[model samples]
Target: MAVDSYDFWLFDLDGTLVDAEWSYTRDVFDRVGDRLGRPFSDREAEVLWHGLGGARDDQLREWNIPPTEFWPVFHAEEDPQLRAEATYLHDDAAELIRSLHARDRPVGLVTHCQAFLTGPVLEHLDIRDWFDTVVCCTEELGWKPDPAPVRHAIRELGVEGEGTGVLAGDGANDVGAAWNAGLDSIHVERHDPAFRGQCVLGDYRITTFRDLGQ
Candidate 1:
């Protein structure tokens, strides 16, 4: 099906819609390491970045870093401005959003990214205005792979039928969420062993929206 095939579109942020380099992953973990004196390894950072581990606290458990202690320092390393600057969107992403607008289809963003980061990144990318709803973890929608968030976004878009909507994301959770909600999924693969596609497979795999075909 083409990009315009669906009446309602639920998207994932971070890797799907935006090219969030998260250019600060290394720097953030480095700072976290300095404070904890545990030091983050490059491979460890990649694992974290890939969403391989459930949560940072869980991932740090092996390293013996206390969640209570590590969270504060890790969160502190989040540089909103730096993140805003580092995150960008694929050229075709903009075209996809505009095409959806022109088609008068309702689009909502359901992301694991909390609001503090999601808001600025969306604004910086200049595409927030295009979405009908943005459900992030910071809110009550819950995180991806659970399906509640995707289901919520579908409802927010007021979609009534099963095949009317589809979730397009780059993570296994994204695929799981769609499966839970009984909706289709499109996997936009950009990187391997990445939150971008890791074990989660999609109903449709496309490197870019154009792969949807005319």
Candidate 2:
């Protein structure tokens, strides 16, 4: 199948386009630990960050901090730093986006990450103009797996037709979100069991962006 066959492409930000997992976690844990008067190590940060998934409420529960207290502290400390360190992008990411755009394929970004976090990353990467629409959690529509945000992205891109839209992501929630939105999903995995059975649920599974053509 040709890439243009997909009228629009929806992508997850973190882990899919940008590598913010380490830096994001470090900041979140540092802020949470500071507010709780506890020590947060990098290792601990990893655990807590991965636990966040696409659910904000669950993350708050894991950190044992209310959103009110958590947001203030997190914004005060981690936000700026995360924005700074999120300059890096996956190899060939820019080329891929450019190619997609050249083909007149509308590209949209739907991330569970809030605007505060995605804003800096987008600026740092200097690819903000690449996307036709961005649906972040801060926008109030809803998060991934709910499908509302995904559907909103599709609507923004004005995509229509069977298999004309694909949601490319790196997690189970991404898969579920695409499924719920009635769009084909492409799971990107860097290693074995990157998504386990989750990848099986996707219409396509690729180890790299290049596989999209195959």
What's the TM-score of each model vs. the native?
0.85, 0.79
163 Cα displacement, candidate 1 (Å):
5.4
Worst 10 residues of 1 by lDDT: 191-200
Q: lDDT score, residue 174, model 2? A: 85
Q: Which lDDT tens digits does candidate 1 get at residues 1-214?
A: 8876777888888778776464578888888888888877877876665555545446678768777897667767887778888887887677887888888888899987777788888778677798999898643556677878887777777775645778888767787788888888998776664442335568998888778854
TM-score, cand. 2 vs. native: 0.79
Clashing pairs in 2: none
**CA lDDT, every prediction?**
0.76, 0.72
* Model 2 spans with C-alpha error above 4 angstroms: 21-24, 38-44, 47-56, 59-72, 160-163, 191-200
lDDT tens digits by residue: candidate 2, 1-214: 5566677789988768777656556766776677768767664554344332345556566767576766566556666445657547888566678889888788999987667777777887788998999999654687778899998888787775434688888776788899998988887765356423222357777778887662
lDDT of 2: 0.72
Name the weakest run of 10 consecutive residues (lDDT summed) in model 2. Answer: 191-200
